[model samples]
Target: MPSLLAVCAVHALRPDSGSVGVTAIDKRPLDGEVRVGPLGVRADVQASRKHHGGPDKAVYAYAQQDAEYWERELGRELAPGWFGENLRVEGIDVNAARIGEVWRIGEKVLLEVTMPRTPCATFARWVGGAAARGWVKRFSEEGRLGAYLRVRRAGEVRAGDAVEIVSSPLDAPTVLEVYRS
Candidate 1:
């Protein structure tokens, strides 16, 4: 079985306060069973619906200086940075997933790679990294970044849910491949 990444849920900024909208009605957890729609969930609070804004709409994983990378790059113990991915999956590299591929979550949920996640100005402050702006630019060049997907089918998803790639488009582009070209 092949896997494609999907954000089970996300925390959005409240319209007024600087606080995160974690428990809003539109953001509440579903009861572990639902159907995927064309535009995804019509409601604002569900996981799939939130990603309508592209990358900013969902996650922001980063590959900064980590203990693993540092050991290879500089040979020292380094703190790893977490990208706030809803599912911290290992084994499969989400960044390398190709576009127009259909990723199924658990059993019911499905996502289609519609585009690459383009970093926005909001990320500069979101990350607080001094070189975040430059980092995003370099990531674009390396083509090792993830993508933005639209919900082809919406359903309840959990953190440890297994994602599977059900379809791969022919001559399609990976997120980075699309970005680079």
Candidate 2:
């Protein structure tokens, strides 16, 4: 049955760090919904043309392996262990999620899947990976990693919360399809 998964920490830029304690948000399925939650909460950070905060800008649960090259390229180490995703889902398959899908965290907070995450140069440098570009490209091709989402509702979220899918778009598109087009 559909149930809430582990609410992961939300971080920006740095993979070995954490930010915004988002826990216990409510996520339920719904119909005829476009903007699932709210804005600013899941909205992208415009700092230096980069997106931060919110679920959309959140990193995936385990997409850092591809960034293995960074360890060598940058001569540094990455942290956060294995749980790479900002949110660790138990039931819902993040990769299978479609664009415009909304997830409720706790009672007031909400998040909607917008588009698949596309890595930037900063991420490559962090991991010290040389072929960072190729790693990102392969990730898109495999569709193993999930997509970026925007915040529909702004609130606090934490772990051990139910992630109820409130809405999902019809004719759901794959991350690759969405990214390619």
Candidate 3:
């Protein structure tokens, strides 16, 4: 069954770490129940509101499988939340989830699939060095980008919770489809 692997929140804002000269992208796994609000995780913060943190992009979820692929390519480990995702999931392809898909996480917290995460200069800067070279272009080409979600129902969430894909609109575009376009 599809399940949550990790629940994370921003550890702190690094004032000198991103394209905008600040970022909350370096997340850390959180223990116990983490509150999910309309804007995002209770303990999380986005440094650049112009590019992140809104009703339509409240929570980011990435596939553990996708992270594994990166680990192999980068020759290093990618711990959960490494991609700045609030949730790291397994047993489901986040990129394949249809837009407008509704997911029931645990017994609470409903999240509607919104869009694919777009790689940006902030991401490239966060990566740095050899991996950062042509990163935006390479990431765009790979199409392993994760899904952004809108919080439909807020609740406390924890790792090990089941993720049920409850519904989706008919003929809705997949995350990958949106990313490729």
Query: RMSD for each model, in Å, please?
Result: 6.9, 9.4, 1.1
The TM-score between candidate 2 and the true structure equals 0.56
Q: All candidates' TM-scores?
A: 0.59, 0.56, 0.97
Runs of candidate 2 exceeding 4 Å displacement = 1-47, 51-85, 129-133
> Lowest lDDT 10-mer window, candidate 1?
21-30
lDDT of 1: 0.47
| TM-score attained by model 1 | 0.59
lDDT of 3 by residue, 13-45 (tens): 776655577888899899998899999889888
Clashing pairs in 3: none
Which candidate model has the greater lDDT, 1 or 2? 2
Q: Which residue runs does candidate 1 get wrong by more than 4 Å?
A: 1-88
**Alpha-carbon local distance difference test for all models:** 0.47, 0.49, 0.91
Q: Model 2 over residues 30-71: C-alpha lDDT tens digits?
A: 222122233332322223223444445643433333334334
In TM-score terms, which candidate is top?
3
Q: After TM-score superposition, what is the CA distance of residue 27 in candidate 1 from its true location, in Å?
A: 11
Q: Which regions in candidate 3 have their CA more than 4 angstroms from the true location?
A: 17-19
